[model samples]
Target: MTITIDRRIYNDSVISKALYWLSGDYLIERSLSDNNTESVTITANSATDISETELETRLMQTLNDFKLRQIVADETRDIKTILYAKAFAEDEDLSEEDIHD
Candidate 1:
């Protein structure tokens, strides 16, 4: 099974980051439609599919790939707080040194 998800937001920086991922090793652009509101689409094929759960597995993998990239950078720590601070901010009280996720 194959699935594609796309959304066009008003922010260019976010679009640039998402586009960088969309264009993968063998990504297909498929068909696209646009308007003054927002250009977005999804294309998928389950016709010649062999695997029983390929669709679900691949979708989960794709979502995880993006989630992994959304982690805040260490360089931005100065602008915010440490893990401890974040913990406190959220009232969790975790250590900033606990870098391993």
Candidate 2:
């Protein structure tokens, strides 16, 4: 159950920053399990127990704002007709089973 970054990580920056926080920069109670064991451990910066308020504050302050809405808009706008067709066909009854020969 050891925590690790997925190998197919499309966003390395996001994963790195999250890993840094999980390793404890501002000191938080985040924990990950040991492989093949139930051993408990704290991050390297575990000088004291992490407080919820402090964790929340650090988390809120470290957020990276991006043009998420704009990206979503572009994706959706380009596929409007495709989406409409899919929506129209979604209500059609179909067999759940797949038959392969």
Candidate 3:
């Protein structure tokens, strides 16, 4: 089955991450279109009972989930870095209250 995804709605990183989960079960190929869209072709490596519509729905859901995760990670990167630094610092005291703050 092949699906075309808008690049504006889903970036390559998110798509790649989502496709990684299905790599073991499917043979996947990707191509770019002139209209700023990505076309992904997915073929089952073995026999399966899933319909194309169901697979498309699942792929869309997975892509959205990964995009949300990517956004969260991007937004919290600085804060996470600080937290990690504090946790590893010998001179800095990382308290439970500090985490809440």
Question: Judged by lDDT against the true structure, how good is candidate 3?
Answer: 0.88
TM-score of each: 0.28, 0.25, 0.87
Question: 52-73, model 3: which lDDT tens digit per residue?
Answer: 8999999999999999999999
Give candidate 3 misplaced runs (Cα > 4 Å): 91-101
Candidate with best TM-score: 3
Error of 1 at 95 (Å): 20
lDDT of each: 0.43, 0.40, 0.88
Model 3, 38: alpha-carbon shift in Å? 0.4
lDDT of the structure predicted as candidate 2: 0.40
Q: Where does candidate 2 have its weakest 10-residue lDDT segment? A: 1-10
Worst 10 residues of 1 by lDDT: 36-45
Pairs that collide in candidate 2 are none
lDDT of 1 at 12: 31
Candidate 1: Cα lDDT at 74? 36
Measured by TM-score, how close is model 3 to the native structure? Answer: 0.87
- Model 2 CA deviation exceeding 4 Å by range: 1-12, 21-45, 65-101
lDDT at residue 71 of model 1 (Cα atoms): 42
Q: Once model 3 is optimally superposed onto the true structure by TM-score, how far is the C-alpha of residue 96 displaced, in angstroms?
A: 17
